[model samples]
Target: MIKLPFTLPSRPPVTRIRKCDAAQLRAPAGPRTQPMRGFEDHFVDIVDYIVRITDEIWMERAVGRIYDTYDASCTIYSSYGVVRSVEEVIAGTITTLNAFPDGEIHHLNVAWSGDEDEGFYTSHLGHSRSTHVGRSSLGPGTGRRSSIRFAADCVSRDNRIHTEWLIRDNGAQVRQLGFDLHEVARRAAEADTLEHFIVSPETRLEGQTPRKLLDLPTDTLDGWARHMFHNIWNLKRFDWLARYYCAAATVHAGGGRVAQGVRNIGALYLNIQAAMPDGVMRVEHVCHSEENDGVIVAVRWVYEGTTAPGGVLGECPAGKQVFMMGVSHMRFSGDRIVEEWMIFDELGVLVQGYRK
Candidate 1:
């Protein structure tokens, strides 16, 4: 049995399990009679607390209560690439509230898994201000707002929040606030192309199979595979470097189509080269299938680039470079690519570079 640094809260007693004849065994009614709460319950409570705080800017109160109940310090890691202690987190919240009194946060969903004292929770949240003008500290402007579908992975200790990794829908937020995402993305793509155009000596095109890619250290391979699509898609002009993935396939979802397989992989490279002249791609993470077969692979990646005039997608003018990231799941057949499912931060890319 695992022991917590603090005493576990006693839940209301549940109905006792009734033993019946082997032939009459049935599920029990009401809550289970187990005296101890499981990891699931702990996770539920933490999620409930997060939901509550989002609805009402209860950072100060919630942080104190969390510290008291869990007997641990609370830290908040933000997607804006900022980390703060409970006190700083509360302060930031207060500032936001003061600047936009009507600002509110809406929690959409939370997906989590882990043990009672240690686990991870990912939640989607949105922030909005109904009135932007004449708000103290907030400059006069249209009452504009943005939504962010963010995810946070947190670790808990002694029932209190510990470490957290926050991820934000950067592209989505920008687009929602009336940004010209397409132009920005095009520009960024072009800029990235100009910056990292040369094929490196380390670049291997022919023998780069999924298994070979996976041959790197697990962490390195994982990162590369995750972002393979974005890198290949954004930097397609370097298709010669991706000869191994030329025959990759693709799968589609969410009303969008993703090209996969080796041939599809080639198409991805071709498309990027055709669409954006100067673009760069980066792989953030790659999650692999558990099957020992070297055929299937999946990944997530990010892209940044600048646009040149006469872009394949449209009349992308020079000047602005855009940055975007996305996730993809791919499957391979034999040594060739087979299928893929893809999603990206389209809105974020548009808004950051083109928002008026």
Candidate 2:
């Protein structure tokens, strides 16, 4: 019998009694049998089973228990695709537990949808301790612990989980670990490569001159770059590339805006190129999202250059080669660029150059 956390509304109970011999009662099915439960009842049972598994048996423990019970590999998928597998999951969990033995696992909520064979489960793990702090400027602070908030779409067969698509709130977990997210995001954005960013095809001019932005082909890098700057960056020519921003395109540099524009971007790139003639800009990734008729492109970029002309940010002196990642979001119209948003690490770049 399954126990429920809450009581149901009262209903009249039938009081019936029948006399039978001890042997007959002990027999399998001499005369009568209880009605079998339906699939809905079984579905509820499965949900309860998972809840119990997560809370009572596996709470605060490593993945050993989960793996043993499910007999299946645990997998995690990011926004793009699979990031880790069950073995890695187990290793990471053990390592984490070793670092934070006093960690508490709190179940914030559980939600499920679809049938018993295919459903999604969303849960949150809170108050995880034992995070390590590194020597970076965005190191972890004291008294804070990380957490895992995740949603997993699962497929079950023969009363066991076969596969799962898990999406975790990594950003939140990182923040909980006491690392400076703004700094991390900035650095990540600056270090991104061409393969990590993307632009949508639905972006176009909202009003006049929509045709120009719409006609831009998606084939070449220059076309992409031009479309990206014109539509995405909304910054003034002289201001830091960290101002005039949007959430879609912004990176984490102390919380400011990075605008979109051609001249401004040209000046920024010129500054970088002049400082490091050997520097090469590579697109790491490009993701596209459609908004009505307009398209938004999210781009990840990496710049590799030597500080031969001295450090542009006062951190690295001349002749020092460095690599950095950054992210950008652009709105396009036809073939022309209209607006853009961007984010990256300004302080870290300067610090790196100076320290190097």
Best by TM-score: 1
Q: Against the hidden true structure, what lDDT does model 2 obtain?
A: 0.40
Off by over 4 Å in 2: 1-44, 56-62, 69-74, 79-81, 117-143, 146-153, 165-177, 182-356
lDDT scores of the candidates, listed in order: 0.40, 0.40
* TM-score of decoy 2: 0.36
- Name the 10 consecutive residues with the lowest summed lDDT in model 2: 11-20
Evaluated at residue 61, the lDDT of candidate 2 is: 62
Candidate 1 Cα errors over 4 Å, as ranges: 1-46, 56-80, 121-141, 145-148, 170-356
In the range 239-330, model 1's lDDT, one tens digit per residue, is 44343343434544211235555455455545444433555566653333322222233333445566444533334445555544444444
Return the number of clashes found in candidate 1. 52
RMSD of each: 12.8, 17.5
* lDDT by residue for model 2 (102-194), tens: 555443223222343343332211122234432222343344555443333344434445455433344455455655544564554455331
